[model samples]
Target: MTSKYEIRLNSKIDIRRIYTNETLPLRKKVLKPFLTEEECINPGDDLTSTYHFGLFQENKLISISTFIQEGHPDFLSTFPYRLRGMATDTEFQGQGLGGILLQHGVEYLRQKECDFLWFNARIKAFPFYEKLGFSYYGPLFDIKDIGPHKVMYKILIPK
Candidate 1:
């Protein structure tokens, strides 16, 4: 069962605090092989970016996600598209936090009238993207210093 965590659209949360939470050890472990220690996007980066959201459990960050407005074709931020960062406390896995975060991201982007929401999902996590209705696109690309990442996108329901 999932604990009570309120997911909201907050652009001011400190990214570092959320990204480094000890509860999400598995998240860190899973993403570690795919991203360098310095390359991981922290909460501060999200707060500073154009669009992002945080999940809180009684004022403490429990999960988080974000997207940046890409002017050209950056992987994380592509021109009004959202590059999603998702994390849940390791203890909270399998309880639906990811799904909640995913839904929240989509809804927030949809409200903003984003043309598309996309991200380079980890190959192992492709099923999660499928469940969210995101279609795989293009050939898989290794994340340079990280593991292979599959580009995925989903059209948002027009507002």
Candidate 2:
């Protein structure tokens, strides 16, 4: 029998705010398979100001991302939101689901008058982010078990 998710692949897609827990399965599967379920939870995920976004087709969540109202010391923005645990299911890779979800988050941040959105992006995902207007912020660095990554940011409300 075809799974509900597979059936929804051709259905309408929706992007909206989702709970932090809703983001974990995809985070573990696509972004941190080596980590335990508890380890997949990112810092500040439960904060009141934190926001999680998901792309869903029917009832199936295909892509997920989390944003925290935390600022990097390097960024002088008065209101900076940090992106974390972004993942698109392997079967849904290259479908632009992640980008569409991210853009939706950007619009949400813009509405909140955020100054910028920043994150430590995996080296391989650089082009994906760059295409969406995020610029590299600092030199490449290692995130322990995660390999090479660079700080990337996009200004939402310039100061």
lDDT of 2 by residue, 1-159 (tens): 343212223447777678888888998898888987678998899998998888887768999989899999987888889999988999988988889888878878887889889999998999999999999987899988889999999989732
In the range 50-80, model 1's lDDT, one tens digit per residue, is 5545566555566666666653264333335
Candidate 2 lDDT score at position 31: 85
- Give candidate 2's error at residue 23 in angstroms: 0.8
lDDT of 2 at 142: 98
Instruction: Please give each candidate's TM-score.
Output: 0.67, 0.90
Model number with the top TM-score: 2
Q: What TM-score number comes out for model 2?
A: 0.90
The pairs that clash in candidate 1 are: 15-43, 15-44, 24-90, 70-77, 70-79
Which 10 residues in a row give candidate 1 its minimum summed lDDT?
Answer: 12-21
